[model samples]
Target chain A: MNVDLIDLGNESRNAGSFVSFLDQICARFELDHAAYAGTNPVASAVHGYVNYPDAWKHHYAENGLHRIDPTLLVASRSIAPVDWSRLDHTEGFEKTFRDARDFGITNRGLTIPVRGPYGDIGMLSVTRDCSVTEWEKLSRQILPDLQSVAVHVHDTVMRSDVLSRALRYPALSTREREILQWIAAGKSQQDVGDILGISHRTVEVHLRSGREKLYALTTPQAVGRAIMLGLIYPL
Target chain B: MIIIVDALNKDRFGDLLDEMFKLRARVFGDRLGWEVEITNGREIDQFDRLDPAYVIGLDDEGHVVSCVRALQTTGPHMLSDVFQVLLDGEPPLRSATLWESTRFCVDTQRLCRDGNTMKAVSMATCELMIGSLEYARRSGISDIITVIDPVVNRVLKRSDNAPYDYVGSTKQMGKVPAMAALLDCTEERINRVRAFAGITHDVFANEDTVRDLLDARQLAFAAQLGESSEWMAAILSGSEEALPPVLPEDIQDYCRAQIETAQTEEEHAAALRLVAVLVRERVHPAMHRLVFQS
Candidate 1:
């Protein structure tokens, strides 16, 4: 399992031979199914290759089954390796459990979750048609590697934008950004004062302070610079 | 080096925590008018001890700045009681692997706001978050969930316009005119309207209303629907009932993705990458991504 985990990370970061490398790991781990789920938190765009039937994905997306997908419940919050057995079974879940079984996802599974700055989350799941004993064996054997691979990949995914922006723009404190954003929104000193509950003069001071820090000539220029640098976007 | 001092265990951190609290009061309380007693001028909370914390900003000598506290989940916390309401009947996340990054107070006296040093502080905070994610990465921690005020929530919720890395449920609890925002909505637009942050009065008019943000609120799902329908859908939209991705995993990916794509005239991207590397080196492993870097 540990070797398998190493292989997975090596494959994901290779940037070449990606698919085959991943497929080999998937097969070595005896995983009946695997997926790389990328979520857009803003759009609620949860896209991944679940071993579930295509019908299920379609239904989940079209009919919004994600709204009721209890598996996601734990996936959304848990920060560790989770065994499907630990899930809180929905009443009558076993009655229709065959739906998941047909898709090879019901046998037994483990989920390795990862999170980054600003609360982004991702998961690496391995499922197989093994008995509880076998599943437990697999989970224990690979949990470390699962965590490692998930973490590394998740880290890489988040830093993908570095080539675009400069190096020094995101260093301001929360309060500074809070004040700058208010001013950038076309708010007058008095208006900014009202929003943040500070004196208009204080708003003036913050704006001036930001202007001096950014080395901009005017208030509007400072606002433009902040926006360009992703410093103070609209709230 | 960032330190996480406990606001509740004031005696432990002593002067630093006291000074931190006073700064908070001056910046948030006196500024925002939450109206708490500010004997020395600082706003403290119970949850300060319940999560792994850090005052990871900067000092004035043009040097890197930070403070680490002892407000970890294994310790005391304000949310266990005051914010337990948000969890309701469900077993929402509250664990060690999943730390709630708390209490970001900078020593303004130590920080130099000249030459984009403010950018340095912001990047440092982002770095701390990224580091926390890395720490969680090695462990079994699956998420990094925390309660945010309306202002922070609104900024992140304007997902349609602003690029914030978060996904969760937003419920309107309590009752009419007093409903709580559960953060379950993905449409980054139309986030819950918040009261004034720096305020003693409600002089802030209702500028951006429910109507303006509804579409942004439902942004995640808007692509699949019609334009007008997307806007109309979010306001009346029901819950995803689906769980949000674990906070740590979600954030890590989001921040990395953002770092990869961020563009700016200043050095925001370098700061972002540097911070990302530092976060991966220091903080817990996580899934949250921060796109706020330029």
Candidate 2:
């Protein structure tokens, strides 16, 4: 597709633009297919030049793998990009993993699990079928950049400001705004507080206020609203 | 890091549409066993322009693949306030959540379509549905409803429960499968669903309305202001071409096995050989041309 990376770099790191840029990247990598799915109530989905079977996706969703979505769950808990193969498959992942593999998921894959300031959990992943040597080389070579790219695209598509837009409120103080922003970016209260030099309680207060203003009943909802509003970026 | 969402610029709409078309042709061709229509590339609907398609998901290359194609029903769609007869005399327009997630398609032909991800109409649709609920919930939209094909509606029903109660019935929509409606799309109904289905909430249609809409053909209705009440019958049941759904348990495993085995090659190597043989045979005469190029 010959897209300008700088343009993608400019977009807030969210799932949308990440999907877009990935399309270009897939072309660059000479790959044929890809997809990006956000873990939300509505569970929005994005697609790359490649596509997957519906029966498979339906099976995955119908089976409710998000609870045990090892990649998504683990990625949510960390800021590092993980190789799909490196994840622990010892327990609670037989069906999901089997299904993923049967569907031709690359044993050699990378998922940059991103946690924003407010506990917004997302993953930027890349998959490919390659020899063990080639896989190792690609992981060592592209893993670092892939993590950053995943974060960037994740933050861009879901650009924060989801708070006010959700509840019809004005923007909050930059610090608090930044906190909500981080929250939408997928960071936890302790993390957000630590980043802003505030107590977890204080972070809670800011989030509570933001949550109230956004009229969100749950933390995930609050983060979702914040992302929709452009109040935060997944950097 | 935080992720932000902004509507795509108008300039990029064409770029997006082209992608949508190609994706649809790819997926529908393989998954549903349907023909492809890419003359001008693909089909464009009235809703495509009015609604901003929201695509979210990661591609295999760790990039974003946005599938944004839908329109909120603020005015009228489907039954069009036009040459339409109301199954419900007054058209059940109450405080309900209803929206048509229409012409949903995704490209599945290329790129080893992901099993975890939705491709073609399915993925595009799932993406739209997921994002729409999140967006609508945040936007304080309560009622949400959609009238979809029966097979598609069954998929929705199986996945999660909606807030408002809905009514559904199969209709002779032609083709391999019949069409049906899943009613009960109210914000309140969706909220209940969110609580129970343990997912985000989105309103869907009311079941009674759905039934009334389909069964209206059986009821008596006044043609004009002073016209006699015309007693109608056999609206939903009139069609002779539509096949009825069998109980899942009732579906013959042996028949399915036969089809699977028939397609097998390598001198009857079971399902695997059958599918492989089918792929080889079809490709040689058909799929082969499409696939060999790859």
Clashes of each: 163, 121
Q: What is the lDDT for B50 in model 1?
A: 27
Which lDDT values do the candidates have, in the order given? 0.43, 0.42
Docking class of 2: incorrect
Q: Per-residue lDDT for B1-294 in model 2, tens only?
A: 001122322332333345455455444444554433444435444434433333333232222233433323222343333112322222322111223333433333332345444324344334444555544443223334444445556556554542222322334332333232323323454454345445443323232343344235223222221121110111113331232222122222432455444421212224333333433443345544545767
DockQ of 1: 0.02
Q: Which stretches of candidate 1 lie over 4 Å from their true place?
A: A1-22, A40-47, A51-63, A91-98, A159-235, B1-294
Q: How would you class the docking of model 1?
A: incorrect
Chain A TM-score relative to the true structure, per candidate = 0.53, 0.54
DockQ of each: 0.02, 0.01
Q: How many pairs of residues collide in model 1?
A: 163
Candidate 1 residue-wise lDDT, A34-153, digit = tens? 554545343344545444456755645775545555445445444345566645365323433446655445637766655433335666666678788877777665554455455444
lDDT of 1 at B264: 24
Q: How far is B58's C-alpha from truth in model 1 (Å)?
A: 40
